[model samples]
Target: MNLNQKKSAFIALGQFLSQFSLDNSARKEGVLHNDLFFDKFIDLIELSQSHNGWFTPEQVHYAINSWAEALTEENLNEWLSAYDLSNVQPKTVGLILAGNIPLVGFHDFLSVLITGHKVLVKTSSNDQKLLPFLADYLIAVASEMADNIEFVEGKLENFDAVIATGSNNTARYFEYYFKDVPSIIRKNRNSVAVLDGKESKEDLVALGEDIFRYFGLGCRNVSKLFVPKGYDFKQFFEAIYEYGDIIHYEKYANNYDYNKAVFLMSLFPLLDNEFLTLKEDSSYASPISSVFYEYYDDLETVKSKLLEDSEKIQCIVSNNLINRSISFGKSQKPKLCDYADNVDTISFLSKI
Candidate 1:
């Protein structure tokens, strides 16, 4: 359908998503096709963990809430206003999605469709259900969406361009396979925070949210910290103590125990909370239950190092210490315009 029609369908999906949250899933009147979709959506949320252990009901609901907040009419209008899609030609755009977090590749799916193109999605096995369920809701809201969205079980084919997200290894395969077509191939990138020893307890607590949310699977999650030398761990550890309950999750606890054992056996010194471990390292991508940290001599040197290694970083969280750094805990709550890897999806879609 046209732009407004497509936007309206997504708005309806967002409204549907708003009915569910970590605390409760309440059905609201006036939401489109709720009779057919609401209870089933709740069922899916309850069943999500069976499909993927990482898809805990709480985390799934958080993801749903995040998207609901993002897909408002005003937000959609503001985001799409920047692009000219009036003269667009429809093409089939293939997507190879990542299953790291619930509905992780949805922005790319929305991007392809909103730009007046057909979407051929190859869902990651870990996240095969959520987006297609939303797609069905969209089709029910606007019948034309049936023609615009398709999920492929086998290999992707007959698409003009592709958007693929994967590890650095799979990205190489995507680059070689989709080399002929204009493509956006995403690779592993991690976010980091800069600490100057002046952050308040509130800020550190919020920073804990950035660290522990979704159990640190998302690229936007702060996986590393750049702290000034001699920064005390007493305040930081106390501030993040609220997140200690995260250790109760079996998978997370297992990772914590295993990783900690490996670290100890290797003679690496560590700062251990009951739930999370902090190790001093220069690496950006930390293991699931740990966050790496480095000492920075000065802010300018850290900024220069980050700039020099920009391609490897997804986000920088700080209290205005670094240019373009996000606030303490806002990394995972990126705006619609916060393109991954700093690549503009809308502009890419408009051109293709």
Candidate 2:
């Protein structure tokens, strides 16, 4: 199918997704395939939790809403405007998805299809249900897409290029395995927030969203903090107090209790706020329910360090303290143009 046809199909999928939310799921009349697929989609969303304990309704709905906002005609047109897709020849692109969060690999899926290439997707077992369901919806909306999309269960084969997401160890395996093909092998990267000790209560509260959203499982979640020397976290803790309800989730509570006990037994210093723990750590990857923090004497030094270790960082959140650093609370809510790892997926797909 052509570019306009592909864009229309995804826009319809977005309209269908906009109907469902944690707060409300009022099925609108005009959304394509609503009569046949709407209720089934809702059932799948409800059943998602059984498939993956972390895929709670609230988290699934948030992911859905984010995509709904992203796949608008305006957003789609603007995102695709930067690329020349008309001269594309169809190629099979293999996608090995990461299921750390809901619909984590949807962007790659969209890129392959929108750029006139076929996609062979191997869904992460943790997220096996959602994307295939949406793919089915897209096919129903535009039957031409059925030939372009395939979900592989066992081995990924018969593809010209590959895009895979995994931990650093698995990324090494991907590099070795896909050595002969054009690829984007994504490794584990964490986001961090730089605190200047001057942020407003609202900014800190928003920063709490960055830290706790998706239970801090997604890469975009701020797992580390860079604070000024002798920075007091009293206000930061107080501002995030509203999210204390997160501890009510059994899985999160188990993690919090376990991680806390492990730290205490190891005699590590910690700042606990009942639900979340803050530990002085130089590491970027923090455990669930805990955030690693390090003190910085100067912004330039921190910037230099981050620049030197850019590959390990996915995003930097600040009040423009460093160039291209996103604002507080907005890390997880990435725009269509905000490519992960600063690798332009669209441009890469256009070339390959």
Candidate 3:
């Protein structure tokens, strides 16, 4: 699409989403602003949660706006310039969607769509409805755009290229089957936060949103913390605890307690029930009930360690501003120019 065409498409999609992304008070309700599509989205999320992702009706608007601009802004598609699509035709690709978090399939779907290829999506059982419904919405808005996309309910046996996401256990399967195709095999990754305990009271509140939103089910959620040694937990805990009432999910509470008991019976003392455990070692992802935190000697030392563990970190949220922060709340809410893994996806696809 040309720049003007892309701009118009995004404006339409954005306007559509902005309509429902508002709360009754007319304030910007990031996720709860669904307008007339509330029931459709809520039903899909209910089913999505049972299998894997814990999606709420609230985060959809942000997600849609992010997806639309990312795909058509022309940045994502620049990757395709490397390949000669005139002779390549529109290749069919398989996308094994990730149910780890909300709208996890978007990147893969996007890579295929903006690249001028056809996507045969294998929906995760837990997140079966959202993507398809999204596809429906896209079709309604721009029917021509939907022609290249297909939401497959089953496996991908006849695709030319592959983009599969899974844990270490399934990485081997991806390796064996997709070895013949040019593909990206993604595994579980943990997001983290780094704190020097120098954050202002206001910054901490915004940082709190990074930790608690979506109840920390996202990979971008800070599963660990890097704190200065001998740091005081009083302010950190209290500032965060003030938002305890914000966490009202019964399942999350149950998980917190069960994990707490396991740690307590073994003589582990927790700061509070509201926060989870923070352990050492490298765990790419954390359970919804707990977090694994680490202590640091200095910024330089921690910086070296994070570089060594780059695969484990996604977006870092910190007040230091020296580098990216260690923790964040939202997952994959990229600006128009925010590329995945800092790699231009469309450029990769266009060249294929």
> Candidates' lDDT values, in order?
0.94, 0.95, 0.63
Task: Name model 1 segments beyond 4 Å from true.
Answer: none
The predicted structure with the larger lDDT, 2 or 3, is 2
The deviation in Å at residue 320 for candidate 1 is 0.9
TM-score of each: 0.99, 0.99, 0.81
lDDT of 3 by residue, 105-147 (tens): 7766755765568888998776777787766665565567666
Q: Give a tens-digit lDDT track for model 2, residues 70-145.
A: 9999999999898888777789999999999999999999999999999999999999999999999999999999
Candidate 2: where is the Cα deviation over 4 Å?
none
Q: List, in order, the clash count of every candidate structure.
A: 0, 0, 29
Q: Cα miss at 120, model 2 (Å)?
A: 0.2
Error of 3 at 61 (Å): 5.6
lDDT of 3 at 326: 35
Estimate candidate 1's alpha-carbon lDDT, on a 0 to 1 scale. 0.94
Runs of candidate 3 with Cα error greater than 4 angstroms are: 1-11, 25-53, 59-89, 273-284, 320-332, 336-343
RMSD of 3: 4.7
Which of the numbered candidates is closest to the native, going by highest lDDT?
2
